[model samples]
Target: MCEIFSKILQVPINHIKPIDYVPAAAAVNRPYDCHLSNNQLINLGININCIGFEDWWKNYLNN
Candidate 1:
């Protein structure tokens, strides 16, 4: 997952630190529907747009 993010963002893995509040920021009041084992993998996939983000974000604001 780190590797993929590094490649996509063209940054080194060591430099690609995960944002501490990202999970909490992304999570809503709904139950956490993800499996811990696949969370990183799934997030990486989402980052690469292999999975659409429309359903992921209710009001996605892309800057």
Candidate 2:
């Protein structure tokens, strides 16, 4: 999912950052109850565009 999202967004895999909730999820101290898996978090970030959004939207809408 992360790979597909990255390709769709034209962003490199390494450039994608984890969502802010990741640390909070990890700090829960419950191994069995996972808030979000790594791949899921990465996919979320890719979907949300943690760093780039305004520029992409501008260019996308203008074009």
Candidate 3:
């Protein structure tokens, strides 16, 4: 997951922390703002329609 985020956001793995939160979508005009797109989520095998972000993430990580 860290690798995927690093690739999409063009940031180093060290820059990504487990406590970070990124909206599923965000305003791209903001300086240094980043978000995860629906397509990217789908490509990662995560259903974009899935609700409960925190719960889903916990389950994903546990799996």
Candidate 4:
């Protein structure tokens, strides 16, 4: 899911933030928890980008 979303949102898989709660991200305007994963939530800032959705997307897409 994240892989496919990465293509659509134009962001890397590492930048996506996931959680038990979805719909908080999932935006082309920004980079956030764009998809819901069944995996355990282990947030160490490894695969999460806290730069919000829109800003992160802009910066990410620019590169």
lDDT of 3: 0.64
What do the candidate models score in CA lDDT, each in turn? 0.55, 0.62, 0.64, 0.62
What digit string (tens of lDDT, one per residue) describes model 4 on residues 2-62?
Answer: 6655765767787556676547466346667688763454454345436755666657767
Q: 57 in model 1: Cα distance from truth in Å?
A: 26
- The TM-score of predicted model 2 comes to 0.23
Residue 42 in model 1: lDDT: 79
TM-score of decoy 1? 0.24
The total of clashing pairs for model 3 equals: 0
Candidate 3, 1-63: lDDT as tens digits: 666545545678875568566676853556576776688777899966756655556567568
Extract clashing residue pairs from model 1: none
Q: Considering TM-score, which of the candidate structures 2 and 4 is the better prediction for this target?
A: 4
**Whose lDDT is greatest here?**
3
- The residue-by-residue lDDT of candidate 1 on 10-60, one tens digit each, is 676775576767576777686666644657867677553344444333234
Q: Model 4 lDDT vs. the true structure?
A: 0.62
lDDT leaderboard ranking: 3, 2, 4, 1
Q: Which pairs, if any, clash in model 3?
A: none
* Poorest lDDT segment (10 consecutive residues) of candidate 4: 40-49
Could you tell me how far off, in angstroms, the CA of residue 19 lies in candidate 2 after the best superposition? 16
